[model samples]
Target: MNVRSQIKDYIAAQPEPKQKDLQELHGLILGIMPDCKLWFLDGKDESGRVVSNPNIGYGVQVIKYADGKNKDFYQIGMSANTTGISIYIMGIKDKKYLAEKFGKKIGQASVTGYCIKFRTLKNIDVGVLEDAMRYGIEQTRV
Candidate 1:
């Protein structure tokens, strides 16, 4: 169906605790970007093979490739993984900023260059996550 419907279905299909957690995160992201464009990726390639986990996306930005090609993509993305949830802050040029900036303050989360992952929201500081997302949006805005 539509992007919102697809996102709702995807979140609803998750198992308990994850379903609830995803919903909460979806709400939080919407609050942070109330007017942003919504996106849903089923993680299928052009041939429809499952290459990655499904993703929920917000906002839009241009992704530049090393080959000089550029693509329009979402600024922020979230997904439920086997062990935890993943939040991706796309379009950042630096690969070490997230870890260096919020590594120690984000609690038990893994803060990589463009991703923050944790087992649960309770295991990390939501405020720090919020801050990171805010910075991501500001930095990646089209």
Candidate 2:
């Protein structure tokens, strides 16, 4: 259906605890960027195979490729995995910036180039995650 409906359905389809966490993250992201554009990716390729988990996205960021192509994508995204959840913060230049700045501070989460993954909300610091998300969103404006 719609983006919001798709997002809710995605979250609702998750198993226990994960479903709760996904719902919380969905609300948190909306609270941070209430006016942002919402998005939903079913994690399917051209063949429609499930290559990855479904993602709920927020905000808009234009991605410029070296081949002189550009596309609009979400500035931030959240997804539920088999083990836990993943939050993707796009538009960062430095690959190590997120890990260096927020890796340790975010608790038991894994901070990669543009992703912060954790088992649950209690395993990580929500404030630090918010800071990273805010940074990602601000970076897109520059």
Candidate 3:
């Protein structure tokens, strides 16, 4: 049905401890961006094929603006990979700016115009991360 329900169902199917970790992670993310509405992308590989493996992870989405203008003005999403968890700011351009500000404090950064990857949640400064999320949400500009 809804994206939140889809994510919850997906997580619910997992085994105990992994499911618990995912629930905690979900709570942490929701707490950080309380206004964001959830969406799912069902990510594809670099080849643009929908990944069939659950272990490859799924995409988390947030509709950044709701002026009833653009359909998907901005999307903030994340994916957990073998390397680390990634925070995607769909159309914002503050990755390098943010990384420069917190790279040393967090960890090494891999950046593009609007995508950032940190090896672990522990590596990021949650306050700064929250600010980044706000920036992403604002970038949609309704």
TM-score for each model = 0.96, 0.96, 0.61
Over 1-142, each residue of candidate 2 has an lDDT whose tens digit, in order, gives 9988898788888998999988888888899999999999999999999898889889998999999999999999999887899999999999999999999899999999999999999999999999999999999862
The per-residue C-alpha lDDT of model 1 at residue 41 equals 97
**RMSD each, Å:** 1.0, 1.0, 5.9
Location of the lowest summed lDDT over 10 successive residues in candidate 3: 53-62
Which TM-score value belongs to model 2? Answer: 0.96
Pairs clashing within candidate 1: none
Per-residue error for 6 in candidate 3, Å, reads: 1.7
Q: How would you order the candidates by TM-score, starting with the best?
A: 2, 1, 3
Point to the candidate with the largest lDDT: 1
**What is the per-residue lDDT of model 3 for residues 1-142, given as tens digits with 9 covering 90 to 100?**
8777777776677665555655665776677666666765556687889783232212233344567553443356665555655666666555466556545554455755666676655555656665765566566445
> CA lDDT of each candidate?
0.93, 0.92, 0.58
lDDT of 1 at 81: 98
Which pairs clash inside model 2?
Answer: none
Off by over 4 Å in 2: none
